[model samples]
Target: MADGAVSINMSAEECAIQALADRVMSQIADLFFAQHITPTPVQQQMLVSHVRAMALRSRTGEPLPEVEEALFEDISPDSMTLAQQVVDLFGNLPVEEAWLLSVHFEVAKNEG
Candidate 1:
């Protein structure tokens, strides 16, 4: 786990989920670095938290609350593409997952 990562009680399965989330976040950090998108510490923390939840959802087949597509109309195509790529890492997530995740990337890019 990265420095400052959340500490939680975990069963064996939850530990695996945390490991998966850590791997995915490492890839995402590399992607952000390659793109010169530096999220602030707070933003990075939020992203990590969100990805942890995403990892659990991926493992459990949980669905996201419905997100309105129009809310993301202002998101850049690049952000959407990147978000979709992240969502694809989980293999079975819905498009709405991408849509929801894109907000984090979009915010980080804009605020970077």
Candidate 2:
């Protein structure tokens, strides 16, 4: 668990997805520590929730709803790189997954 660790109650069948989400959280936590970023509690909650959904999407092959590329034009390259690293762990997610995830990091980076 990271700085803003969350507990998610799930049925037995989804335990693996939970594990994956936790792993992602751990990596995010490490990034936060390494970069000296401290997200507000609310920001952390949103990031965690989004990470959980990403894990579910990875397992279920659910596509991310289409998002405009211009929407991410202002996101920092470092944040996008970190988001892409996390998305790579799933091995099956789309590049747009990184684009979407980058928003989370950007928000946290801006606010923290």
Candidate 3:
């Protein structure tokens, strides 16, 4: 280890898992844009809230709260169609941009 730094290593499986997480986030962002969901301040707040709840559940393996449940609820009524748009848009993002957006999404998901 360096003077004040600790070294860390990730297994291939761990790396893949992280990559998959990034992809999901990027897809969500693309969906948000494609749906014309211009992230208003309120929507941004909701995004943050949803991400935080997801992170907590992910870490603790606990059920999401009812309040959080509403955030993930099918608000669009045509979520299946919107989801397809997201997938299509995500397919077109550059690799670097997609990865960067994924990081932002992950952070927002955890901290929003």
* Predicted structure 2, TM vs. truth: 0.86
- Indicate the TM-score of model 3: 0.38
Give the Å shift of residue 76 in candidate 3: 4.0
Clashes of each: 0, 0, 2
What is candidate 1's lDDT per residue for 20-107, written digit by digit as tens? Answer: 8999999999889988999999999999998999999999988888788998999999999999999999898888888888989999
- The residue ranges of model 2 lying beyond 4 angstroms of the native Cα positions read 1-10
Query: Residue 18 in candidate 3 has what lDDT?
Result: 54
Global local distance difference test of model 1: 0.91
- Model 3 agreement with the true structure over 1-112: per-residue lDDT tens digits: 5598876788775565455545655667676666454555665665545444343334345643233333333333354344333334434322233222243333333444
Candidate 1 stretches greater than 4 Å from native:
1-9
The C-alpha local distance difference test score for the whole of candidate 3 amounts to 0.45
The alpha-carbon lDDT assigned to residue 76 of candidate 1 equals 93
lDDT of 2 by residue, 1-112 (tens): 6778787877774998889999989988998899887889998999989899999999998888888888899999999999999889889999998999898888888877
What lDDT does the true structure give each of the candidates?
0.91, 0.89, 0.45
Question: What TM-score goes with each of the models?
Answer: 0.89, 0.86, 0.38
Superposed by TM-score, candidate 2 places the C-alpha of residue 85 at a distance from the truth, in angstroms, of 1.0
